[model samples]
Target: MTLRLQPVRLASGNDDSEAQLVFAGNALVAVLTHLAEHHDGEAGRWFMEAWFGPGYVLNRPTFASLDKAQDWILERLAEV
Candidate 1:
């Protein structure tokens, strides 16, 4: 079972803007984080508007290492 991992671009960059989302997706699901850290306005914005919902606020788990990143992605699979 090969996972088709693809990078996710949060926005088109040309100037000083928030960094791209440090997240990826496979055929089954996509996992995301606030990028390098949490409380990231842009990342949080994308999660709320795109994946989760207006009222949903995902904050507890964040990617810190390679293993954690993978876990984060798997954890979000249920939502997808």
Candidate 2:
């Protein structure tokens, strides 16, 4: 299976903004890990919101392997 990376632009007040994306699972994890390690809390939160959506519900087993995560995302995409 192939995973796609789609770009997203987020607006933060007037003139301020940030850019992010929903990438292939591995890519997503890599990006998040980098942000978590390097960026401050607000930046990390912004990235998470873009990736998971604002009303995202986090259940148990909050994270998964890249392949599993990609599959899960693809399944959800199919539903929409």
Candidate 3:
């Protein structure tokens, strides 16, 4: 399977607007938001804002980078 990421700005009503739309092939699989400075220790991490399809539910909500997030997403996708 192929995974793609599209940069996006979300109207999340907070400083955490910078995000990425994660797609598995042509299907959107997840939305990952960048944690804002207000998040303190968690700031600058990637947060799983949303997920779709089977086996996408997150056991961990934060990732150190988009690559890590995608790795986790791919693992879940593969499980289905």
Most accurate candidate by lDDT: 3
**Cα RMSD (angstroms) for every candidate in the order listed:** 7.0, 8.1, 1.4
Q: List the residue pairs that clash in candidate 1.
A: none
**Candidate 2 local distance difference test against the native:** 0.40
Q: CA lDDT of each candidate?
A: 0.38, 0.40, 0.89
Model 2 segments beyond 4 Å from truth? 5-21, 24-61
Can you write out model 2's per-residue Cα lDDT over 1-80, one digit (the tens) per residue? 35665544445443224334555445552121112323444333322333452234355122233345455556655554
lDDT of 1 by residue, 1-80 (tens): 22343444455343222322333332333334334234455333323213331234455343444355555445555455
Tell me each candidate's TM-score.
0.33, 0.33, 0.91
Task: Give the per-residue lDDT of model 3 (tens digit) for 1-80.
Answer: 87899999999899999999999989998989999999999999999998885864646489999889988888888887
The window of 10 residues in a row where model 3 has the poorest summed lDDT is: 51-60
Q: In model 1, how large is the Cα lDDT of residue 42?
A: 37
* Shift of residue 9 alpha carbon in model 2, Å: 17
Q: Model 3 residue 48 lDDT?
A: 90
